[model samples]
Target: MSWRQARTAHVTMTFDPEGLTPTQREGDACVACHKKWPRPRIRIGRLPDDTTLFACPECADALLPQQDDTHSLPWRVAFS
Candidate 1:
């Protein structure tokens, strides 16, 4: 995908409601950090297995693998 398409896809994926209810968003712990954020909100995404995960931006950065660099690497290097 082009940069614009990649960026758009990232935005769409990152903005998913994290499969949360209003009450859950308010009270649920981040799947990574295990803490509920107050202001703004946590981002939600799914695993390859279609299991949902929630994370704060900080935790997300640490929890999610780096797609940008991975995409640019050879398949072997990307996996290694």
Candidate 2:
């Protein structure tokens, strides 16, 4: 399946290997498409109220903005 523009910029994926388990399964459905996902890479999005929602890779990619300028923002400023 092809990925589309993002729905929002609050989406993210976890990379913590310690948090994963062989028997662990993702029971949450994609917030955008409402489809069940079994894959280990779960997508999470933050709501307006700060609540986290899970989505599939397709949905996450589809929901992300195509050209967001905020990505250029600096995390820290260099002292002069």
Candidate 3:
């Protein structure tokens, strides 16, 4: 599949509300760091009830899988 197709096919994981705060649960805070200011704009995941979970750009990058880098070596590196 192509990069565009892969990206469009990407599926975000569901978040459990039990571990999240009220703000996070309400989508007012960043799901990863709880940063309230600037408002988390990236949709990282969703709650059990399908409520979208937001994250800052930095945190979203950390949470989501990295896109295949064309300049990188053919062999991909996986960081845990």
Model 3 scores a TM of: 0.72
**Model 3 alpha-carbon drift over 4 Å, by segment:** 1-9, 69-80
CA deviation > 4 Å runs, candidate 2: 1-27, 39-44, 67-80
Please give the CA lDDT of all the candidate structures: 0.48, 0.46, 0.78
lDDT per residue as tens, model 3, 1-80 = 11233232147789889999999999999999999999988877888898988898889778887776765445355332
Rank the models by TM-score, top first. 3, 2, 1
By the lDDT metric, which is better: model 2 or model 3? 3
Candidate 2 lDDT, 24-58, residue by residue in tens: 32335566565654631444544444445565777
Ranking by lDDT: 3, 1, 2
Model 1 lDDT at residue 59: 68
- Using TM-score as the measure, name the better of candidate 2 and candidate 3: 3
Candidate 1 to truth, TM: 0.37
TM-scores of the candidates in the order shown: 0.37, 0.39, 0.72
* Clash tally for model 2: 5
RMSD in Å for all candidates:
9.4, 10.9, 7.8
